[model samples]
Target: MCKILFINNCQLYFIIYISLPTLEKDNEIIDIDPFTVFGLFNKSSMKEINRKSIIKYIADEFNINAKIPTSFNSIPVLNNQNATFYNFIGYRNDSDIDDLWELFSSALDYSKNPTQANRDKVSKFFDRVINQKGNGNSKITMGLYWISPDTFLNLDSRNTWYIYEAGKIPDNIVSILPKVEEKISANKYFDIMKKISEYLKSSASNLKNFKELSFEAWRYSEEINHKEKSKKVQSQRDDKGSGLADEDVDTIHYWIYTPGEGARKWDEFYEKGIMGIGWEKIGDLNQYSTKEEMKKAMKEKINPNGSFMNDALATWQFVYEMKKGDIIFVKKGRTQIIGRGVVVSDYYFDTTLDSEFPNLRNVKWTHKGEWEHPGQAITKTLTDITPFTNYVEKLEALFSEDNDGEIFKEQEIEYPIYDRNKFLEEVYMDEEDYDTLLELVRNKKNVILQGPPGVGKTYAAKRLAYSMMGVKDQTRIMMVQFHQSYSYEDFIEGFRPSITDGGFEIKKGSFYNFCKKAADDIENEYFFIIDEINRGNISKIFGELFMLIENDKRGNSLQLLYSNEKFFVPKNIYIIGMMNTADRSLAFIDYALRRRFAFFEIKPGFKSKGFSIYTKQLNNKKLNSLIECVERLNNVIADDETLGEGFLIGHSYFCNIDEVNDKVLSNIVEYELIPLIKEYWFDEPSKVKEWADYLRSAIK
Candidate 1:
């Protein structure tokens, strides 16, 4: 027998020719040196030789599968008999390559045939599989390539270097890779895997062959390195650039959550500098291998009731789905929103935390204040509100760098308890008017709903406040009618006799009390609505607050009259004042307060879509004709020199579609509109009679 021997780099390699017995017997040893046989190729050629022949030969000697073994019998041998992805060999010596293949097969087919206990087993196995490859092992790439040739690319030191040279990695990853002395960290490896997965799944690029793409990338990277070494000058930055591209950013979901029972620990969360949920019995979610397993654990422990599954699902989302960089909004009680932040760390179980809220994530809170109570309270412990575009826009605005604590400004008024549109329709107001009114209120921070009597100014004012708030939270809203007797002492703070006891107490007026309430809950919005605002002494009742009510002066402190305490109207508090324009005896509003408030004229709403819809629902031809007559009467009233458009008989007189008929219409015409007409044209009795005859004919 003869053995062919080759020697290089202080290591020996021999090719055995055992069957050549004649040559062995003759001692015909070919004395040709292996260097002469192989030829003196440069270091670069040697690297290629090492990559193609030496590395592949070593892998082959270990019986690497031909064309990726489909069955267990065709797989390469595993040195550790019981080696598995989840755990190291544990006393079982009989386990073989088939067991390992079974594990990998389960992982490969995991998404399709998933088991509750093994839900996270695949991800856990992934790390183990990578770790099991040992240092500088290229078999991991081989396995991935075998599984999905089109999806997975090879990962090794050389290929990693290729990717690095291309400058397509995050600075953190770039910083860590070269410093890794033993093995790449699971985080870095997983990050790379995520990047590759994203690139392959991107809809922008149509790439099929991952292997070829990887080879080209490596080759190009090598060329770049060579050019840099030869020229000895800093090269132009690669177009590939570092880190994830804008399109490559993971689809991040924004969520709102209230922690603990009734948000008891919400203050603690903001104080503790963290955001979290309350499910400690389930233990650390990170310890679970799969979401299904975590859910199983939750189902076993948690009270399985209505929305339990949904709550558990939200918990799963919090633990697993919520990645670092996701936005989180914290809701306190049902009225206030606070602590807007970006998740800065992975989900962790804080054992030191009380049982109420132990599952936590680190967050960098960007803003903290009361958001004008957005509609109804956030009921869900965790809710994804990404589907609502308006909420998203508001969220973006709140999180912006220059945002001056403007939170929950715009709100969607779709609540089960409050039928905003129905209320508007009842008041004969249209959606366009409602939106405009809300916008005016939002921008100006102070607004007045002024219109003629019977135009639904008072009715529309409260509904308008509710619509702007997104919920009809009566606690956040207070209504006070201004009158001749209503003074600074009564509207603001003053000493008043207490009814409960025979003593005097310092009484907090409606405005003062409302401002204090607003200040206490700065995270929520409060409304101080004044009906017949012009009926009171405009400058007297408001006093020093007249200047403070300006949008810019909100939150600026001023000395009070009675208590002498420094006070200011909170930014979260919005003032909505109602004025009856037909009451011309009332003094004109102080110009100082006039500029501060946005005056929205509440018209008769005869041409309003709400009125049209209401009339259509009633479907009364006579009533419709009555509306036309009222419109004609309004034109005549508007043309009058004494009684102008402001004094026109409003649609509110004909608004009660449910109650309006010949009798109710006649009563309104005879007792209401006739009297108003008599007052307007007392001198021109014929003019009043003409309009009354016209109105009476419609009711007839």
Candidate 2:
């Protein structure tokens, strides 16, 4: 058994030395500082000491009076508190006491525990004390012990005890015990219980309950003050009006009250006549003087159901510019009232007041929903009047009964316009040839400018039409290319229906619609140009319109499929077709369609004046050399089986200035030209090779 005293902040334990034993030869009693025994100092400061020194220090201080182990069972006293407790049980040797004492002494020297576990335990214990005090009005003392007894053989000796400052112990000792327990005796149990109780009572007296009344009182005061302030703000608003009333005064006040409250107040105000005059009190609002007099005077000016009449009482007074149709309410002498209605028939006013009222003897009165004057004409002025009075007078004179009436006389009038000959001289084109083509366009529906490659065949058609029409806008012309897959169904209307309401609907195509638009625009001419006309399946693409392509059949209506929508090739629309002779695979253009279009060949002309200007711009020696080489090569290949006259190099060959470098020109000749020739003469690679060699030589 060991004697232990557990105080409020510290635990004291003493080992019992029941029997003395001889130590080993090397074991000697050593002296250790008290601070070292508490394990509070650093290891370096206690490096000169050992565990033996610590045990010797404690043993020397207490001498042999230190409590000894015995067969007696006694309860441990934990600092004057009355509570049940137990001792820490563990293994112990004589050497163990020396180790504990040395740890304690070194800790005391450093003013802190040497080990982390001991330091944390001490901190947590103090935290629990502070927290407990913070939460409630209670004080507590906790005790812990590191006990090692000689009888213990293992390491489960650490324990703690909690003691309340209350209660006492029983004294029936020997009688209450079992038979085996009666053999042992313990006399210190009652003393230990008394000490624990005394400690608790002393701790309880120092505690006080926490106060919270100040915070509670503050919250209650703030809530009452907020409610009182809100009531004051609402009361202020009730004394002032929001300005929405319907009185005749210049400054009237309107207020909104709680639903029932407003209605009650309204009834009170009405009884006191505070609401003033309403529209209903004004008199005899529907009397007018005469039928024609009202028509000429006031009939045109009244707007009875207008905004002003809708809320009549909302108007303050009738002081404004007076007009017909104005409902005037005037205050007459003491108890009488009078009302008059203005009747201005036209927008103008005569300003003459008529006192004699027209007779109502011939007029019959009829009852309708509202009051209205009978036999009165409603007068209104014509809107959007033009200032062309002279033009109107002249038109009336031309169709008058005194003269032979004619809306339009076919009288020839001369106007100074651009003379064709002078305009052509300024623009530098042949006037007779231009006018001939222009006349053909005005009379004909279809024309084709068939030419060899690169002769401005398409350009001539466009320029001639533009010059004749004196039109500078490029947007008026519609140009398209004809190919093998181009069809009448795409050009004209087809059964191209859309799924609408679970059924299909046919839609019109572009050509049919464009022609319809052209027919409607009778003053302007429309040009439809087709490039590469020979490459398309012409007869198939034209369909029944092949006959209508002629000038005589134009403007004749033709019915299409799916609907009775008639399509006419408008006379204003001229079709110009451009064909390239290089397209060898193209089928022969139909003879019937060919007769409709006049063919004009456009060939490469090196001697033309335009070609001379084109060549002069190329002043580069290499380009001139290239042209000369191509001309010589063309002479040789002209008689070849796979090459012909149309395949010869045109003046357009020297026009491309993009590839100014020799390397780029070589690539253009090898890649672009050779491939085109190879396609045309696939079975004759020798002739293709010769042509490429000539082109490559021109580049060098």
Candidate 3:
């Protein structure tokens, strides 16, 4: 590499630009892709990266053990104990260490000779370890840096991405770094970082060290900051429009996204059938544990305004929260709707994508043209408009005009698998009990799972249907909660106000529509789950359909009071109702309704093999003690004349928790269990406090 020359002519300055020679070692050509990273946490905030301390800790701790030649204790273990640190990536657990230690030890030799041949060996070793193929490159580079920080810089994804953003990387770099999971030789990785670092150092006026170069790379890399934001140009298209066939309006989430200012990316995204966003510097967002972590990375690399919490949140939601089948209303400028799309795929970070927007999701663009929203939409990059039902309805109505009353249909079926075994593990129930419940539903056609709170009644109802159906099949399952105000008008067809009619139009209720859908597909069984079934006035809600719910009368046709049309409960439809027996405000189910449907008592299963296995696997003394105490309390409640077994404390409160710790136990005791206990024994204040103290002490 040629040396850059600087000449001082009086007080003025003259700088010379020189293209460096190709780096060679051992008579071999050295090639490394440009704009690859090392680090960038904005030195000022994360504490300056200490060079001497990092090297010293590596020398002391990371040296190979003679007893286990391929092993060098874990870096994360030292991190757990607050040992001296280095900021790097890809060592999530000790497995990566154990998997790559043989390759990792080679760094000591590479540092000694620092040959191109040896550097190539590290990358080749990574590919050989097939288990680590995805994250192999990350480990090798950081592992090499750990041994010799100065000789081999740790260019993490964040660092490489920033260098790309700074425009230091040539266009050809994409051919080399083709995907997020790029595998480059260690020789090439170091060569590229050295070239970029040297170039950054030579170009600056007062840059002192490599750390400052990191800060400069971060500061200079820019686009679409608040200052460059375009002025609002309202869309000239008319506000009113129409949409296509409606399905699952309640489940769909509506969103608005801009390809770029004035819809510059419309052609690319529309033709490719995709929608995407910038902020490619953060790498694959899935790696971030939470939205807050994604936001933190955005702050250091993208320099997003910390005060704009919603703006920061949009970046994370774009990758993780956005789901397939969600609606997207594409907009150009403020209030201008350019297109409508349905998400067809999950978010992916494709490095080969258009560099401007590397994060993407495949979309089926249904409509493309100019239309205006009834109101000015949120100006954020992405906005969830599902809450604005009226606005969404109007938007759909506008799209309905495109075909001039002629419309087409598009169907996408997604059946997530949830079989009987999964149901057994999750519901804290055994095979015999599960078989009985399924048989009861099939025989009775309508059954209520009556249990105390935390017995997993509602949880089991959905899964029971899943196990019966053999697939999750959300399309076949419909769940609705019934309350005091629920009625025939809400559960069946009813007249409601319409904008165009300027009068009332018959609007179909959720259950009525679901029944119609099920009736159309008579061969397949459909399950309808009603939560808090006892809360609503059953006679008022069911109306004439009350008699039809009986297994024999299911296929019998009935005339509706409102529409006067022949409607029959499909023979294939089954009902699963849930009743919280602990709710004392209500009386027993009507005798007329009770006899038609089977009532299944779902008891607490603390002693069930599933629950026992779950508890042992968690292996927490506090959790074990707490469960034993709850069991004793359940016995006391069962014996009480006022409460009995129906209102006993359930085991669901402790089920499926990720871990049993003091914080979780305390929350359950203070907020969940204690409140229920206070309500259960309201007449006896001392008793309530006694049980509360007992439960609290069990965890403590």
Candidate topping lDDT: 3
Better of 1 and 2 by TM-score: 1
Candidate 2 lDDT by residue in tens digits, 397-500? 32223223333332222322334543443232344555666676666667776644545566566555556556432323555677778777766756653332
Model 3 spans with C-alpha error above 4 angstroms: 1-267, 277-316, 325-341, 348-359, 366-414, 499-503, 689-700
lDDT rank order: 3, 1, 2
Model 2 residue 583 CA deviation in Å: 1.8
Q: What is the lDDT of residue 289 in candidate 3?
A: 51
lDDT scores of the candidates, listed in order: 0.61, 0.39, 0.66
lDDT-superior candidate, 1 or 2: 1
TM-scores for the candidates: 0.41, 0.36, 0.60
Q: Write the per-residue lDDT of candidate 1 for residues 1-700, one digit (tens) a residue.
A: 0123322322323422111111111333333222111122112212222323443443354565554222221112112222122222332223322334543555457435546444355445445544543312244443444455454445645555655655654455455443332344434544555565565456633433456556665555545553433222112111111111112123345788786767677677777778777666666554454456666766666654424567666776776566666678777776777667777776666767655577888887776766654445557788876545345555565555424634433222233345566567556777777778888988899999888878988778766666666665655777777888889987787887654355776767667867876888898888777877878888888889988988898989999988889999889988888888788687477786688889998888888877787788888777887789988988988897887877877777776557656777777778888898788888998888898899889867
The whole-model C-alpha lDDT of candidate 1 against the native structure comes to 0.61
Query: Per-residue lDDT for 1-700 in model 3, tens only?
Result: 1111111121111122211121222213222111111111112122122322322332344473334222111110111121112112332343443335545555556668868777666555545442342344444555455456555554555445655554545555434442334566544665675565565466443554444544454444322121121111011110111111112111446888888777799989999999988776766555455567767877866675665477556766676456678889888777788898899886766768777788889999988888866556667879877655556767887787554456645456766676888888878887798889889999999999998998989778877887888876766877788898888888887887764446777766767777888998998989888888999888888889988889989879899989998888888899988999998887577887788789988989898888999999999999999989999999899999999988988888887699777999998889999999899999999999899889989998
Worst 10 residues of 1 by lDDT: 236-245
On a 0 to 100 scale, what is the lDDT of residue 21 in model 3? 24
